[model samples]
Target: MPMDRRSVLKGASGIAAASTLSGCLGFLGGGGGGGNQGDAMLWHAMTESETETFEESLSIYNDENDAEIVAEENGDLRNNVETTLPTGDGPEMYRWAQDWAGNHYQRDFLYDASDDIDFNLEDTFSQAAVQAITVGADDAVVGLPVGGETVTLLYNKDMVDSPPETYAEMESTMEEYHDPSNGQYGLSHPIDAYFVSAWMHAFGGYYFQVNEDGEGVTGLDLDETKRGMEFVRDSIWPYVPADTNPGPQQAIFQNGSAPFAVNGPWSIATFEDNGINVGVTSFPTVDGNTPSPYTGTSMWYFTTRMADDEDRRESALDYAKWISQSEERQRAYADAHSDVPVLNSISAEDLGDQVAGFKGSYEGGIAMPNHPKMGSVWTPTEDAMNAVLQDDADIDSRFDEAAETVRSNWEE
Candidate 1:
């Protein structure tokens, strides 16, 4: 029997906990055939709930069509794909974040779906979802986006009667609830680049900006970037715990010590499991400017394994089209996993409040740059954030150093 939404939802917490423990393990090997195989295989690292919903959708598709597609859940999908695809041993397709679209396309590892796929990409998916998988000149589509996610302000309903609407109000609430002696905090927020992207965007700064030539230009040394970092250091960091790791930050919120947390949809199931009445909303405005978090899509990327084989390519594309175009299948994924569906037909009202809240957040977010050079920006930015938030280093100097590091890394 196919798994239902309730069963998937019930197993979410255990799946999340297991994933945390197995995150570092790589693919164990012994999967089906690769490039020459007639059947289409998909490698993914989806959680238990997402896998169940996806398999149910696939089962329906397989029954109605001649194409036979299989999903292999790997703990280290990204690494495995990167290492195996070049040798022609990778699966026909893989499900991953759209940010890898640029890198994979550049490496000649992706199949351009725009050339052969019949679906109307722009009309079927949201604008941001389409943009996430578009790479190189003339906007070549390297993948089909299924769902999206972004960070939002999640508050405990018992502690906060209404979610804060502005940074000033959030700061005041943080001050009121902060008690270092009791190991309590007003808010739990990670200081990494991914989490801090919202703050940078609110201050008119960005880690990287695509230029007129479609190349990414580093923005680490921008005055606005420094201002955003300073704002966090001065106004927000005071009430937050010194440990900026996501695990500890989430633990604070999960245990009910922190009333507010800036997290993604992946965190909702765990929070709910912990018995917190969580409410999701867009981040509070900063000086009349809304914070735009980095929005990312979970997409199905076709690999070169199917590129030269006409039959395999057709079968893989058929599966992609079937999965992406079906509103019922997409809605099932949203219901089971709290994802913001990319399908235009699935309105926010169709899903529950949790998905609606994330939809609002995703709509207001900045599509994360998929440029390959973006890989060079994270480490240096994290170093800068750690310096400013943890060690009280000078923001300007730290960012200046970070900018130089990014430039050097790109050059290398």
Candidate 2:
């Protein structure tokens, strides 16, 4: 994956020519053509804004080859892959994050892509992005990188000439700037499942523990992660109002109602367009080490539903390798938007001098846990994390309780 994951979240301001991308060969819209269709490949992805991206990308890929390709916005692949695959109705390729790669690979539902695909992991992607996706004891290759996105801190320059460099400075700045009486909030921190884990890890806490052997892993390392949760609980509230939830507050932050907001580079344009002079920084360090904001990478994976069907698999494999390795294509893709390209050759021109400490995120960020058990912990974790943020209980005690729940839920 590319060095900066933060870029993907940015709106498509600088993206390369969408028309040129539509020229790619074999990308289709719907999934139903027969085997006779020249190298037709189907793709399944989420209904995210990014999904349209892959659809547009397919038009480009189809232009490259005399083949029929289709990309369907299938939403959550986790729940649908089963029925779709067994019926041979699954897409030839599916968009998935690295976290979900392992469990499916272990279930024998995913293809061992390494055999047919020549992925220059060393050359095509950054080393850290590679590690973030790999799994199992052997860490076999299960898929190819579609894109990589990172987390970055965004601040309003008008509020503070210089944004805080450390956690202490940030908190103090928020306190000084907060003016709830006039309806101004210093920060817009959200307490939801998708984001809670992100902030928690960035602050140096995590949900699970994996041993050196990589076999014994546990849930919610409260012992180590509690500090992160507490930090979130204590530092963000006074500056925020009760009614402002994630989506609305994010709007507030963009509109200048909040001076400080924690978000990825994807949200940069929103802040910029609203006349907010913006600055980007890495997530601040806590103790000796900076908290690890989680990383999420998108990839193309083939399903075993067509395991015995060699022709489509070969076509799918060929297409996957080509786009992934096309430095020109990847560059164009990034030029269209900021999501970090998997191709290592991509330039940092889009980011330039605005973002500091980005390389740190590209290097340090770890993928969200992909293990099956991961889905189960979000509810309890969010509840506990939310409780702490509202100051309902002692941070120490609340985190301790969350940790116990996480540990009990861990399967592997």
Candidate 3:
């Protein structure tokens, strides 16, 4: 089975538990600072390798600049931030997905550092990265984008001579290799909204779009969305396993039973570790239209607590800029975590072939909306998809219900 994000986080949390116990003992023995009081604290839930690389970079920063920045690993990071940040008692800075920027800023938990940050946004990061962290009426820059990730076409080089360039060719390959009795498949990908977004985008459908009044509106009921759903049901569903979970889908590809899979960089190491010769490429075109997956950036966000203290805020900004802007640090992230470096100076070639292959997909991808309403779209969309694909429910009606549910959820 593929080691997905949840499994990785669970493992990291165990390691963090041991480290936290050690810190607690030290604090009790007089070698201590009590709980984010005197020094700047950075809360993150990075994987083990990523945490190691970040700690190395941070140690250098601390030694060279006389800064007292402490990194803390949190198991339930998002929930902890939402709960503690409003009380103004959390860390000065936290690392999270860029999609949370608008929600956090709207709740008065974020610090807008647009004017205070030293570097220019346009000149520093990719356009998608910049857009992901920009929010609100005045277009406040809420966070510093450090890395990006997106789904792409991953295939087994031993099975496929060359990846298909068009949907028709891909469908033909699926037909040739699909054998349900033997547990073999041509293609494998989770049936979740995020994984299937590329298909919807190729059919000119979108999940949520900002309206004239800067409000997010759901596109679940759109005709294009129905068409996209129908295409997946009729064309792709027949070849894939009935189990829509990512584990089963990914196992098919990892075990060499499937030639191609749609996944992100997180799954790359597992595939290679399993001895499958993996190759990354952009999605096949659909009737001359390229499929666009949703792209997300992970960034360091400054909290309202930091903004209240001048010294802390300055230190936080300096650390954020140094870590985000340094090409060497960004390269370390790319090498260690398979993160797509957001720095404009770091090209895909500088990282490796995997990063290079994902470049086209990332370029053509859509930056995921950072609006708070985007949170309401996910469950309804996934539920509707499951109904239509698993239970053979009517796609149009299910999507209409989903659209209504999304609107109702957002209103609440």
Report, for every candidate in turn, its global Cα lDDT versus the true structure: 0.77, 0.59, 0.77
- Deviation in Å, model 2, residue 39 alpha carbon: 1.2
Q: What is the lDDT of residue 144 in candidate 1?
A: 80
Check candidate 1 and list the clashing pairs: none
What candidate 1 gets wrong by more than 4 Å, as runs, is: 1-38
User: Candidate 2: worst 10 consecutive residues by lDDT?
Assistant: 19-28
- Candidates in order, TM-scores: namely 0.90, 0.80, 0.90
TM-score of 2: 0.80
Report the C-alpha lDDT of model 3 over 1-412, residue by residue, as the tens digit.
1112233222221131233221100111111111565458788876555667879999999999988888787766766788888776888888876777877898899888888877788898998889888898788988787877778888899988888899888888888888979999978887777778888878888888888898899999999988888888887788888887766787788788988888777667677767889888899998898889888787888888877788888888889989889889877777765678888888777868777667668778988788877877887888899999889999989999999998998777
Better of 1 and 3 by TM-score: 1
Which tens-of-lDDT digit does each residue in 1-412 have in candidate 1?
Answer: 1111112222322342444321100112233333444467788776555666778888899889856787787765666788889887888888877777778898889987778767687788887898887888778878787888777888999999888899999888888899978989989876677776888888888888889998788988999888888878887788778887666777788889998988777777778878899998888999998888888787889888877678777888888888877888878777776778888888888988888888888888988788788878887888899988778899999999999998998888
- Tens digit of per-residue lDDT, candidate 2, span 1-412: 1111122222121122122121111121332322324464555544344455666667777786766665555434455665556665566677666666666776777767656655467766877567655666776666777666565566788887776667778777777768878867788655454444545675445766456877544445445567666556656555677642545556667678777876654555556666888776666665555656666666777677446678777777777777777766565545444456666666455344343334446556766665555555666666676676664776667666776766565533
lDDT of 3: 0.77
